[model samples]
Target: MNERRKLLLHEKVEVRQLEEGLGGSWHPGIVIGVSESCRKVRYDELLCDTGKSKLIESIPVTGAIEGLYQRPFVKSNYRGRIRPRPPSPEHFDVKTSLSFGVCVDVLFKEAWWEGVIFDYNEGGDERCVFFPDEGDERKFKLTDIRATLEWDEFSGHWRERGVWTLVSLAKEHKKEGHIFQLVKRIWSRLKVHYGFMKMISEWTCGAYCLW
Candidate 1:
């Protein structure tokens, strides 16, 4: 919170901005300048600014020192709203250890690439042991490793038009005695009668099964 008051020009920070006639959310931007007259700040976008320096505190993080907030409190008992917690490196680290071999997207030189975490480096910095699709094996810092939802999974889960079922769908997918049953029944008998099957194939264009 005190560091928020001491925000310097050109300092990069993730800030919350509420816009007029629009929604509010957190965004990453550089602090272009600070208002000398007031506690406002000038950052990206026309109207986004920092709030009261003293009040712009993060939710208390365990082991975090007082007077500064890097992340917001995830739960608010008084407001009765569960605030989303910012992504933590510790969570990712634990996930890497628990869920090894899971596909992950790693950021390298500003570009995201598909990879898997096989191991971790035994160093002061938490570097990931990554195997990329390009056949390059290397260790990366946590800041450079990010996990994004798989595109196919995201589409299937969100659009509901894909092959995978993402949610608890109550509606049954199969119905008894559907129209195609008649076609299947006929085709089964026809194939058994070789002469009839030959004649039918010659008579009709072709047999096609509907999904």
Candidate 2:
């Protein structure tokens, strides 16, 4: 059954935060009470602050249907953790056949990361695709792949998220210098090795000439 139908009372959940300063964050919560129709629920919003979590009883407000309620989507993996949930896979329709070298966003470590499909197996009910990112190869179900797109800030509209294939994740990783650092380290090691070998060869030639 789907997540909505399977959600029951007392089950832990991660509620999406829509409020200011906490927008886009997924906060830990639990189903404390359920209405007769099951359309409405009273859940406790576990306030997460500085690695501490405290529960606050959900109270229904007048004329507000979304009061202290959420769609109980993914199960809560929170142990005093608060971070934005990855973009919903439902946003993109994967109708086309995924082939090798196709750039796609992968749900890795609870975040949508840029990845390229290297290998694929379509025999099973859920197609398994391999992505080798940062020298680590891992298999992911087809459902976990989303079309790579970037939000166009210049447009100033939510619907303007565009697919600029040439610079898919370039701007996003500018602040993260680890990739540049890794490349620099590899280059430094190669330079050191080359210098050492050149010095040894010169010394050997000089010794032979003197003999």
Candidate 3:
């Protein structure tokens, strides 16, 4: 039997982004794994708008702005503060006495919003169903709900809060202009270019090491 190697795992941390010796941004991240050398750490990277978790490594722990996982806000230029995606099943508690067709308040940015149970699954918790929209009532995992909202009739927002406004959305569909199409082309090219660079980086490192 072999003894396990020691690893430094950070529960909550902020990763600072530095580019071109100019701009800097902080991103929420958690150290999930450590490299065999103990020189690098693999972490759950949280992105703005959509809470996308991506693994980033081969960097020193000093690169991260140490902090708590409680920081859920990601600064954005277009939408200001975009809430990151909810934590995985590990971090959420999904027990509820509320039943199907019951009105509930969904959690968003520390506030409760309207949400309705679409369908109750046989398996409770982590599999609770919520249908906030009518025509597009989609069944979601129990972990998706923020919390159950209590009925308040006296509030002025009874009608508005009774149902989620974001679900029943109204928007105009305008044809994409030439600028939009051009932006898409540039974006695709940038992706290919960055991907090529990443491939080269991995290949260069792999060539120098035998392990």
Which residues of candidate 1, in runs, are more than 4 Å off?
1-99, 120-124, 152-211
Model 2 per-residue lDDT tens digits across residues 1-211 = 2223322466554443344534323444556564532322222443335435554444332211222234333212111121112335475444434554354556554444444444435454343332222323467776776654332112211221232221223325444445333433433453356653453211111122221
TM-score for each candidate, following the candidate numbering: 0.26, 0.31, 0.22
Rank all candidate structures by their lDDT, best first, as comma-separated numbers.
2, 3, 1
**What clash count goes with each model?**
3, 0, 4
Residue 141 lDDT (model 1): 68
Poorly placed runs, candidate 2 (over 4 Å): 1-50, 53-96, 120-133, 156-211
Better TM-score candidate (1, 3): 1
Candidate 3 stretches greater than 4 Å from native: 1-96, 106-113, 125-134, 150-211
In model 2, state the lDDT of residue 37.
28
TM-score of 2: 0.31
Model 3 over residues 1-211: C-alpha lDDT tens digits?
A: 1122222465443333333321122344555555543233333443334456455644442111222223334312111111123344355444544454344544333222334554435356643333222112334445446443221111201111132221112112223334323323433453356653454311111121211
Models, CA RMSD each = 21.0, 19.1, 18.6
Residue 147 deviation, candidate 1, in Å?
Answer: 2.5
What is the Å distance of residue 140 in model 2 from its true position? 1.1
